[model samples]
Target: GYILFGPADSLTLFSGLLVLMLAPEFFQPLRLLAQHYHDRAAALGAAAELLDRLEDLPDKAVQKHENVRNADPGAGIVLDQVSAGFKPGQPVFSELFLTLESGSVTALTGPSGGGKSTLLHLLAGFLKPDQGEVRIFGLAPGEVRFGWLGQQPFLVHGTWADNLRLTTPDASDVAIETALRQLGLGGLIDERPEGINSPVSESGAGLSGGQGRRLSLARILVANYDLILMDEPTAGLDPDSEVYVIEALHKLAVQGKTLVFSTHQPALLTLADHILSVSGRGQVLDTSRGGGHYE
Candidate 1:
């Protein structure tokens, strides 16, 4: 016997709980699928909406490609003894110094809830470090413009092209076309009813997780930035798309673009010229892949 308590809404909440609690003898596979497949399902919804947005945006000039380097295309990033934590009272990782230079892809891998994302957030200027300094191309985080793609692909509703053009409103048709072709999306563009102007629902509804991730990656590819920061770039992608995106990342690195992405898979990590693994407590794992070659 359960004692009923709280306001009118409480009983409804309790009833919902009863539905879950009463289903103990239900099929295990269904329950497992619901739990395990949630992220995958959500990824699909996100991907579809992203495609729609890509089709909707107006044509504009692709951002001008400016070659930059630490001395001058891709410069190295430097974090001098930086520390970060959720609150002022307590900090997780501290005194971390790392250099992820241009012409290489660095994977930020670590245990679950480790400060890898937090470290990225610090480097991206989304979160100010509590200590030390973060510099890009010898400029502070705020000075330089970089692109950021997170675990969940985020998009503005409307059309697919609109989302693509957001980073570069002035992108010419040729530039956009080239970008699409580079990512094997040229045919996709043609298949869509609106071409690049295809409509996307909010937060990428119709596309699969892989499609959304690729679309977001495509947007990042089009941006002219010194550093590209991606969190869990391959988390929700299909095998083919993940491989495509990973290879594309390598190509960008070869082209002298600095990339720092977080990954949980060793396969996806192999392309990384460098690997920086962070611990659950914010300590970075050593023995990172060496041979920093851009060519």
Candidate 2:
């Protein structure tokens, strides 16, 4: 049997134990709040950086002068003394005078970071040059009807059909199937029991790199733009896939769409109607006509 301690003594011991049991509960909310605050700070920093980037973007012309109707009737691209760069005095290419005829294929090739992509961006109206002018279809670059295939094509999470439909929402089933077959993606659809409904994850998780590139090309076909600008169109593709994509691109060119692409692949370069070898200073070091071997 335990001896009875004094009431004051027992009360003191009980209070100490109670305090120890409640200490964690007291600080748990504070610890959680601190972690949340840290996350918020990180998010704020990222947002601020993004805002700075947005602020740096060149402003689009507000006037309606950049419309297709204001341009020449014929479709082609012309760059006159165009100079561009992300930073001041450090241009990717300077004083470029390029002319791409309608219904022709032109390839631009150079060492990495040599401004091939920057030229495409200038043509695509994503970036404005610090000097000179760009004309597409006889109008400003923004007025041109065009499709751009970037180094990495983005595929949203959805079915294959859904992704294609994003290019042309009212595209018919036959048209969609036709575009897939043209891009050599018919086999992908055939393999899937779900067919066009086969699920595609973000950035095309289930598709191989070549398949994704082909799929992106097919999406371009559905959109049916006048000019198709591609950056490293066949990069990371297997030999067979590259050949197939090249063939598809040839067909597109034959269909009268102007094609401009940047590539290091000899095979792809061979497909060009004209090849411009870019120099470190962003000037065309050499220009060669395509052998038209595939034709």
Candidate 3:
């Protein structure tokens, strides 16, 4: 308006046009600076969130040399005056005294939030007791290698033999084949062109949940761990997979291997030599042994 309406000399008109042309260029550095600030803020926020999550995680337990001991065949699992939980000063089960005999199949039946898994963790040496002792085969928990069948069966992007050989690298091919057959995976293996060497996930298709779990059990069968622990072995399994798991566990029990498992299935409970009912409040009642309760 000043250039068009007001009196303006050539020098002033040229200066006004030059400023208008250079205005965006003049603010270009400031705009870039603002964008960088925004990016820095987002990055810092993400880093802070990651740091908080890391802080919330529990510290990794360091294994002590003294805690390592050889397995004693005669001695079984013993939880004496044990109290443990995730939080400090709050125990899931307190002053608990329990004993499991060697070569026995013990079943832990309990509610969802009950300490069944906690007890298993204690036995597996995944968690430490706030007080007292947890002994497995007269040795500290985790001192000896054992079979663990968790709810989520682990698998890899490899062949059937590769998955089975994960835990038992020295397992013979014959042993691998036998284990798969024992777990009712024989049909699946035979169908594959390369048998056990065939990729577990073929043509972008992986095994079903049941098949994956059975494959995990096949590993246990080949490894021949004297003590095996399973959590909800039959949970979410199809009827066929359930039968295979039950039969496989029975076979293991017959081999004089001590098996401890947590389950709600009646079929699994029948396999237990001793059934212990675990309560949500941490009480364990031995339903099979004269209804004795452990405190």
Candidate 4:
């Protein structure tokens, strides 16, 4: 307006247009600065919320005992007056007393959400009881190196040998082959061009769920752990895979390895020397002996 209205020689029309064009460019930095400040504020708010959440979390103290009880190989597992649950004052098991014999196959059978997995977790030492004591072979739970087979099999982006060696680092090639054969993975390994050295997945093809689980069991076989705990070992497995798993577990039991597994399958139940039915009401009934209760 100044260039158009003022004296003609004072400001040229071209200079006026140039200033108009550069005006937005001159303020672009300031606009961006404001936007950046807004973004920074948002980020800080989010970080503050995260920090608050972290602060609200309960602190977990590491449990240590100077005189740790030595593991007694013959003690098996004992749960005395135990109570546990995810929430305080709501226990899954209240004053539950149980004992499992060594060198025996025990099966836990019950409805879903009946605390089968919770009991396994207690044995695995993945969870702590709200009250009472849990001992595995006279030692505290999780103190001993026991075999654990969860529903999901753990595999890596490597050869079969690599996956098996994850738990048993010093395992020999012969032992690896033997373990694979034990779990009925021998043919799969043999099919690979490089045998055990071949990558687990070839041509973007990975093992099926059952085969993957078998591979995981093979690791337990190679490790030769005295106490093995499995959570629904045959759940979601194909028919053939289930057979392989059942056979492997049977072999383990015959070898006098203490095996505890959670299963509802009739075939698996037949393998158990003792069958305990866990109920949602926190009642554990020893169904093997014509309905006896364990308290």
Which candidate tops lDDT? 3
Worst 10 residues of 1 by lDDT: 60-69
Model 3, which residues run further than 4 Å from truth? 1-69, 201-205, 289-291
What's the TM for model 1? 0.71
Candidate 2 local lDDT, 1-295, one digit each (tens): 7898566755687798998999999999999999999999999999999998877454533343346447663657878888888889988867778777888888988788877788889989999989898888878777756788887877889988888888689988888889888888888899999888899998688789888888878888998887899999988889878888899898888888889999999988777888877665766754674422110
Poorest 10 consecutive residues by lDDT, candidate 4: 60-69
As for candidate 3, its clashing pairs are none
Q: lDDT per model, in order?
A: 0.74, 0.81, 0.88, 0.86
Judging by lDDT, tell me the better candidate of 1 and 3: 3
Worst 10 residues of 2 by lDDT: 286-295
Colliding residue pairs in candidate 2: none
Off by over 4 Å in 2: 1-66, 69-75, 289-295
TM-scores vs. true structure, each candidate = 0.71, 0.76, 0.76, 0.75
Model 3 TM? 0.76
lDDT of 4 by residue, 28-87 (tens): 999999999999999999999999877735442122232133567588899999999877
